[model samples]
Target: MNALLVITALLAATPITLEETRTQGRKNTQALQAELDVTVAREDQRSARSNLLPQVQLSAGPNLSYQGRRRQVVTIPVTETEVLTREVVSSANTSDSYGASLGLSQVIYNRGLWKQLEQAGVNVDAVRNQSIEEADTSELEAIRRFFTLFLSQATLDVLQATAKRSEEQLERARALFHAGRVGKTEEISAEVNLGNDRINVVQRQSQLVADQVQLAVWLARPGTEALQAVDPGILQQEPAPAPALDDALKQAREHRALLRALQQRVRVAELQRAIVRGDYLPRVGLQAQYAHGNQDLGPFFSEPGFGNTFNGGVTLTWDLFNGFNTDAQSARAQANIRRAELTFAQTARELEAEVRRAHQALDGQIASAKLATTNRAAATQGLMLAEERFRAGAGSTLEVRDAQLKLTQAELVLLQSRIDVEIARYALYRATGTLNPGDSQ
Candidate 1:
C-alpha cells in the first residue's frame, strides 16, 4: 500500500507510479471473474446428474363415448297357472362409456443412465479445474496491466523533472540578464526550451493517465487523472522465488485445467462406448396397473354393470439391431476418445514449453532487477557529487544537470526492472500451475 497524500505531506512526498494505483482494481475484478467461471462449470456437472434420477409426473383427463348393440346372457322365468302356461325371454340394446388416470415411471434398469451419471460427475470436477486456469490467466493479465501503467508513470516523472529543471534555468538566465551578465537572446532561448519541456511533460502525464485507465477498467473502478502518493515502496516490492524448469513443467501437468478437461473428455467417450455396447444386452423392468369400466348386457339380458381389472408384468427391451447405430456410435466414441488422448498429449507439450520459458524469464528478470538497483545507487551518488562541485564553482551547471538526469533515468529503469521481475514471477507461477484462486479476499 502507498500512503495517501495530504497537502502538507505532498511537500515531503516521494512520488509513486500509476501502476501501483491500478493494480488493486484489476486484482479485485480478477476474483469476481474467477468465481463466475467456476460456478458456471460446476452447474454443467449438476445438470448431467439430473438425468439419472427417477421421474414422476401428475396427469388428469376425462373421456366419453357412445355405442350400439351391447349384449349379455340372461336368466328366464318359467311358471304355470289355471288355464294358463307362460315362458319368458329377455333381449336389449344400448351404449355409453367414460374414464381417466395418472401415471408414473421409474428407471428400473438402463445401462446408459448410470454410466452417463458417472461421466457427469467427472465432467463437473473438470470444470472446477478449468476455473482455476481462468483465474491464473486473469492474474497474469492484471500483472501486465499494472506494470505497463507503472512504465508510463515512470516516463512521465522523468519528463516532469526535466521541465522543472528547465523552468529554473530559465529563471536564472533571466536574472542574469537583469544583472547584465547574459544577453537578452540567451534568456529568450531558455524561455523557448522551457516551453518545449512543459509540453513534453504534459504529453507524458497524459500517457500515464491513459495507461492507468487501461488497468483500472478491468477492476471496474473510476480513473485517476494523475497518480499521487507520499511513498514509493509499492513500486519496489518483489515477488517470491521461482522454481526450477523441470519442477514447473511437472507441476503444470498436474494442475493445468486444459489437461484435466481433455482427460475428462476422454473418460466421457469411454462411457459412451460402454453405453453403446449395453444396447446388445437387455433392460428389464416391473409394472402394475388397475382399471375400471361399465359393461352392459342387452340382447338376452338387459343391464348396466361395472368391474375392476388388474394387470402385472415384467417388461424387457432390447434393440435387436438398430441399423448398426450401436456399432457406428461405438466407433465414433472410440475415435473421440483417441482424439481426446491426442489433444491432451499436444496440450501437455505446449504447457511444458511455456513453463520452461517462464522459468527462464523469471531467472533473467531477477538478475536484471539486481543490476538496476546497483546502477541507480551509483547514479544517485554521482548526482550528489556533481551538485557539490557546482556549489564550489568547480563544475558547470550542465554537468550538474546531466548527473540529475542520469539519476532520474536510473530510478525509472530500476522501477521498471522491479516490475519486470514481478511480472515474470507471476508468469512462472501461472505456467507452473500454482496460481491460487480467491485473491480478491
Candidate 2:
C-alpha cells in the first residue's frame, strides 16, 4: 500500500499542462542556439560599424645600450711652435631610451567600406528575423508532439473502455449459453471478440508508452516519470472561422518571419553590389601621429634634448588594376542580387500556397468534427437500444455485438476528428506565421 501511494504521488506530480511543456521545450538546446545566433549577429554589426570610427593607437617602449671609448693625440700649432693636444672619442655609449607615440586614422572616403557597414546592418536584421522563425518552428514541433501524445492516450483510454464492455458482454453470453438461451457459437463469438479487444488494448497501451517517451525526450524530463495529458476537452473547443484566402495571404506577407528575413537578404545583396561598384573608386583617409623620444625615461618629456615631432597628412590610394579581381567580384555581386530577388519572389508564392492549403484544411476538419459528433450520438443510442433488446430476449448476441462495434468506431472517429481540428487550426496559425505557445488554445 505504501509503495502504491508513493507511485501515485509521483504520477500526480508528473502531469504537465501544454503551456508548461512548451516552456520546457523552448529551453532546449536548439532554441537556445538560435538565440545565441542573434547575439552573434548583433556583435558583427558592431564590429562592422567600428571600422568607420576614428582609430587611435598608442605605443611605448624602453631601450638600453652599452658603449666603449678610445683616446688619441693630435698636433696643434701656436705662435710658430707645435704643441700636443689630447682628443677623446666614444665608439659606444650606454644609454636608456624611452619613447611613446600616438597615431589616429579616419576614413575620409571609402564607399566600399561604407556599403559593407550597411550590409552588416541588414545582416543583423536578417539573422534576427531568422531567429524568430526558428523559435516559431521549434514551438510548432513541440505542439505537434504534444498533440500526438494526447491522441495516443485518448485512443488507449477508449480501447480500455471498450475492453471492459467486451468483458461484460462475454460474461452475459456465457450465462445465456449455460441456460440454453443462446447457442454455443454465440458464446464462442463473444469470447473471440473479448480476446480481440484485449489484444487491441495491449497494442494501444504500448503505443501510449512510446508516445510518452517521445514527449519526455522533448520536455527534457526523466524517462522514469509518467506523462499524462490534460483533458482533451480543454483543447476541443470550437475554433474561430478561418479568414479568406486573400486575407490570409496578406497576413502572411505582413507577418511571416522567413519572408522578412529574405527581404533583408535582398537588401544585403543590393548593398554588396554597391560595395563592389565602389571598388573602382580611389580610397582616401586622414592620418596623424605625435611622437617623443629621449635617452632617459623621465627626462624624455622634461628635457629639450628629446626629439619631439608631430605629423599629419591625407592619403589617397588607387588600385589601377588587380588582375581583374574587382571585375569578377562585381559580376558575382550582381548575380547574387538577382538570385536573392528571385528567391524572395519564389518564397512568397510558396507561402501563399501554404496559407491557402492550411485554411482549407482547417475548414474541412471543423466540418468533419461536427458530423462525427452527430454520428457518435446516434451510435450511442443504437447501442443502448440493442442492449435493451438483448436483455428482453427480443434481439440476438450478433445485434448487440454489431451495435457495440459501431459505437466504438463512432467514438474513435469523433475523438480523431476533434484532434484533427485542433491540429489543423495550429497548422493554419503556423502558415500565417502567428503560431506561438500562448495561442495554442
Candidate 1 whole-model C-alpha lDDT, 0 to 1: 0.65
Against the correct fold, how does model 2 do in TM-score? 0.85
Off-target runs (Cα >4 Å) in candidate 1 are 1-47, 64-98, 151-158, 166-193, 221-241, 290-310, 385-398, 437-441
What lDDT tens digits, residue by residue, belong to model 1 across residues 1-441? 011222233344234443444345335665567667667756766776666554544433334454544444543445543343344443453445433233434567878777777776776666666655665676567667767765665666666666666677667667767876656775776677667766776676557557656765655555653333323354546545667677778777766666777788778778878877888888876665555444332311232134445566668898897899889988988998898889888988888888888888988888888888889889989977975674454655566567767877787788777878877877877776665533211
Return the clash pairs for model 1, or none. 91-299, 92-298, 92-299
Top-TM-score candidate index: 2
**Residue 331 lDDT in candidate 1:** 94
Q: What C-alpha RMSD separates each model from the true structure? A: 8.1, 4.8
RMSD of 2: 4.8
- Model 2, span 1-441: residue lDDT tens: 322443353366467667877677766667778889989988888888888899999998997877677665666665577675767564766778888899999999999899988888889889878877777777667777778878877776677677778778888888888888878887788888888887886677667677778888776778766787766464457556667788878778888888999999999999998998897999999999999898776788688555888999999999998899989998998999999999999999999999989999989988888888899889999989988887766777789889988988988898888888877877888888777524321
